[model samples]
Target: MTFDVPDASYYGALITNDSFEILVRKNANTGEGLFLRWPHDSDTRPDLLVQSCLDKEFGVNAQLIEGYDAIVFIKGGSLVNFIVHYLGGDIEAVGLQWVTLKTAWELVFKLEDHEVLLSDSASLGVLDRWIRNRRRKIAEESFDGEQKKWLEKFDRLCDRVRYVLGRDSACYGGDGLYSEYIKSIISSAISTMKEQEDLDLYLNDLFGRTSKPGRSAAREADLIQAIHVSLALSSLDLYNAEYTNHVKECRRVLGFLVALENIYGSSSLEIRRRAIEGGNGRWRGHDKAGRIKSDQIKVGQVKSIESAILKVLEDKKLYRKSDRVDVIAGKIAGAVQGEISTLGLGDFFVDKDLQLFIWHFISENKVARGLIK
Candidate 1:
């Protein structure tokens, strides 16, 4: 029952890494003619096709992680399956440039014309799926190089605070210790303000007096909590909070953490915002705009998803030929919204796509598939 379109189909490779970067070969510098040119042979299985494309394109070995018919192109109504691959650090191949996912998306949207060999859906869907599924992982790894180095510096400062506090354990061993402990530290700073200028400034900052007013309370809470956490890390024998360079170091650390907090929204909100505001303005795993196609859940495979979808159809008696297709699809989509949102598919799946997919699946039993026209 293959349609009379081009006998050619396409297979694409989506190379990604732990650092949230993707490997892609740009068409000149415009990134138009993307996706590896895959030879279609009926005898060739998907895994073999992926491996062949990888070997031919990158001249490197690839371990196939996952594969899916991620999109259907309208040009020839061809279904494109993108194979997701995780490249090892040992890659020495030339031509393939590694770019961050954000850069990759930017390149994708900049295309004014689609390539004959490359389907826009294949490119967009694969990238979108990866981003939605790995948003948190991406954010966590975003702090790898310079950010990690700075964070480690902050950690060392907190460690110093812990060591100083550990020197005086006897006084802080009783109940209501923090109240007395912090007060004693403050009293020491005030009484010796002239002798320990750094300690006095640190104490003033610690007590929230030095900070500018009307800052975000949530962020301020995070800074205060971090200080409390450092203090809580260890309790030793110390007469008072010291006036060493650790004071300035601690202040610097707090400022860095607060800056990170503001940008990342505790490292979660910014990612969510980007996911929503990025390409299509929908957060796939959390929003209703995401889609799930028939290929995403093949018949009789992925029973959890299949059964869930079918149950919705059955509950509304939408399986009957007499039922209206639009009503049936809408009901099914709404009913399975919760399940679909958790399936890690990107937000590209809309109600119209779900309706079409339903009609594609059950039209034989109810109405003719041609009726979709």
Candidate 2:
């Protein structure tokens, strides 16, 4: 049997006036399938794509924010093309309702295999990208207005560091020279931040990320880039924490710390010194007076467990224990159990180790200085 699949399709993200909601639809004919998209065909003119979708779906015009590349999908032995548009405004559309991203994701993605409404690539792609973009937009909104221009300049410095090191700015913690270089940069930045009483003034400089050519100057060049990279990351961490009221932390800085902790273990004196000190406002209020409370345990022991705890502490600075300790332990045990089936050290450790580590971490970090005295 010979059959042809449709050649072209179009979809868009229609954001609400407040930008907190997106227009979505449920097709009653298709078992009430949830869709965060509008339908399009190849015949539509490129110039009128957004307007056409607006006319068909809501009969109201809205601002077009951006257009993404055409995403091609293969279904039923045929190629179907889709163009994604990011739109914003308020509109009343038939068979559609404006829903928060959380509600939309739960309905579209959190479904049984048979109940999946976003089975098509177009819907899934549009929904995924829209959510990600929206979150970033929100994060950016948290930035201080006065620091906005300075923030862009800091971003360029970070970009230059990534370029010179031949590392992707979007990636973190790999097993290579570049990764080591990144670590060094972050370590240096943290170390420098500790001594500066006025963190803002210290960071308000244009430093170099590239080293001068020649073997003699290579070390100096490396040092300079390290400073810039660390400054960029540190800036992000401090600004995000301050502006977002600690509701958010810079993802890159958090990722780097996780990776660094995984490799060095959380208890490593070297790692602790680099991560915990330096007046980085992000690490402020941490109980640095006491040492690691686990006398029975030492650095390099049960690192996977520590890494799990680190994940839970994403909302906090170094050494602080999250309230979700039980949940954290359960997740760690589950991970170790899954790994046990495939040559993991499940027998070498037990749940007690995780419990003990958590206790040690909390005792050292959570206990007040007055109590320690």
Per-candidate TM-scores read 0.35, 0.33
* lDDT of prediction 2: 0.40
Give per-residue CA lDDT, model 2, range 243-318, as digits (tens): 4422132343333333333332344454443232221212234343333334344455445545444444453322
* Residue-by-residue lDDT tens digits, candidate 1, 151-260: 44444554333222321211211112222334354445445444555864655565563244433544444344334533332222121223244345456545544542
TM-score of 1: 0.35
Off by over 4 Å in 1: 1-8, 28-32, 74-79, 88-93, 114-118, 135-373
Question: For each candidate, C-alpha RMSD in Å?
Answer: 19.4, 17.1
Report residue 17 deviation for candidate 2 (angstroms): 4.5
